[model samples]
Target: MDDKNSQTQTQINLVVAEPVIDIPTLTHRGPVKQRSPPPILARFHAGYFRISLSLCGQAFLWKTLGKPANDSFVIRRLLRLLPSTAFLLLWSIALFILMTLSLLYLLRCFFHFRMVKGEFLHHVGVNYLFAPWISWLLLLESAPFVSPKSVPYLVLWWAIVIPVVALDVKIYGQWFIKGKRFLSMVANPTSQLSVIGNLVGAKAAAEMGWKESALCMFSIGMAHYLVLFVTLYQRFSGRERIPATLRPVFFLFFATPSMASLAWESISGNFDTPSKMFFFLSLFMFMSLVIFFFF
Candidate 1:
């Protein structure tokens, strides 16, 4: 009886046994499993994307209704409504959340500097440097609407913008000058972040009456933008390789030049010849994008 039971258990084990190796099939059938981004990267993915909100806020603030006003009860009430308040709230929340995430990200990188440097810092992490500063720009711009006389807010903006700008220098220096690895990473739209950050910084600086600093930042941004723009255009035009999910971000091609124009106008005090040229360039890019995307 014992021998019979033992034999039965062995037979059960054989019946349930799994293969130790995957057998190669003659035909491929299933969808391939896509590799996920690393944990450190995936955690701050949302932070990297806060630029979309910043851009939207900038457009609404600078282009559409103009800056928020608290001169009258009616205007203040209007600013408090869903549309205006929504933009302010969205911009504020995005900035704070990203700022916190950025601090955490930096702290983690401190401990795992080797792995981060070898992997993300050279790749995805470099692109993310723009998000925090862009958030800062949005926050700086928001001060007038939130509190017109908040000196502390302005002071904080100055403090934050310096380090953010320095971080950009370090990262871009590594990529463009030291590593010379920019060409290999040109496909992603987020690569435009450095230029966008500078242009936005120019706007912020100009608002603070730092015209010289604004011009310097804007010039550096525009100089690099021209090269990046042409390279990215050449890259994307040759291939329909971008995933459909990522197609919306191509709007950034229009955004960078638009922002450059706005920043130039801010610095020059008028939309003169150069400013108009930048504006027209942006308009053309926008129109081209619309036609291509819709048609």
Candidate 2:
């Protein structure tokens, strides 16, 4: 009886196994065909991209703020081990892997244009689309091998920034042409991501000695940031509509100002009066939100 039941279960399992699709075979067999990725790849979305953003940001921070093992007395005592160069190299490699995986998944998503379009139209999903470009910009800035003034670096900047500007036009244009009702309807804390994308690009431009271009990008970002900021603060869009996953982006209230201050400093070449103001505002907001979230 047990052997019979076992044989039956094995047969059922074999019958229920996933299909092996051959696109060429299907196309040759008939005019109709569909291309689908493995189930694991199909489940990927913008939410899975958050980790790369965090990794790129940390890599950039380490490049800007970290010192060699020999140079840092306090850091040496704390970490008690590997050189900072090892850390940076590890992060750079990890970033490359993550970016490659993301690109492949994105290519798969693009193959299914309808799915990509649907995501583009989704209010929350649309905002997260800016993430990949932002990660690329951060990775560029943190690359120790590439000098900002190099021709290759210059070319790479244009490649990355152009998409950011294009997205700005697409998203911000909708807000402008569609007007306040549309803005109110779509506005959410993660909407601030659009603002950060501009600020990050502006900072990268300033690093490349493109002052006027930096200012232009910064102005557009700040202008819309103000509108989105106010709309979100006032709850004109209604708080309940925001997804639970995105509520953490409430932290952007402080982070946007922090990014703003950093971008202004890059553009102006000094942390002067306005830069100081932005810095202080971000600090206060960070502390306040820290308390709010904890309490």
Q: Which structure among the candidates has the greatest TM-score? A: 2
Top candidate when judged by lDDT against the true structure: 2
Model 2: how far residue 42 lies from native, Å? 2.2
Q: Candidate 1 overall Cα lDDT vs. reference?
A: 0.65
Expressed as tens digits, the lDDT of each residue in 47-78 for candidate 1 is 34455455546534632344444355554555
Residue 165 of model 1: what lDDT? 76
C-alpha root-mean-square deviation, each candidate? 11.5, 7.5
TM-score against native, each model: 0.65, 0.81
Tens digits of per-residue lDDT, candidate 2, 39-115, equal 55556677666777888887776665553433665654554455767866767675776677678657757665667
lDDT of each: 0.65, 0.80
Clashes of 2: 0
| Over 4 Å off, model 2 | 1-35, 67-82, 179-181, 237-240
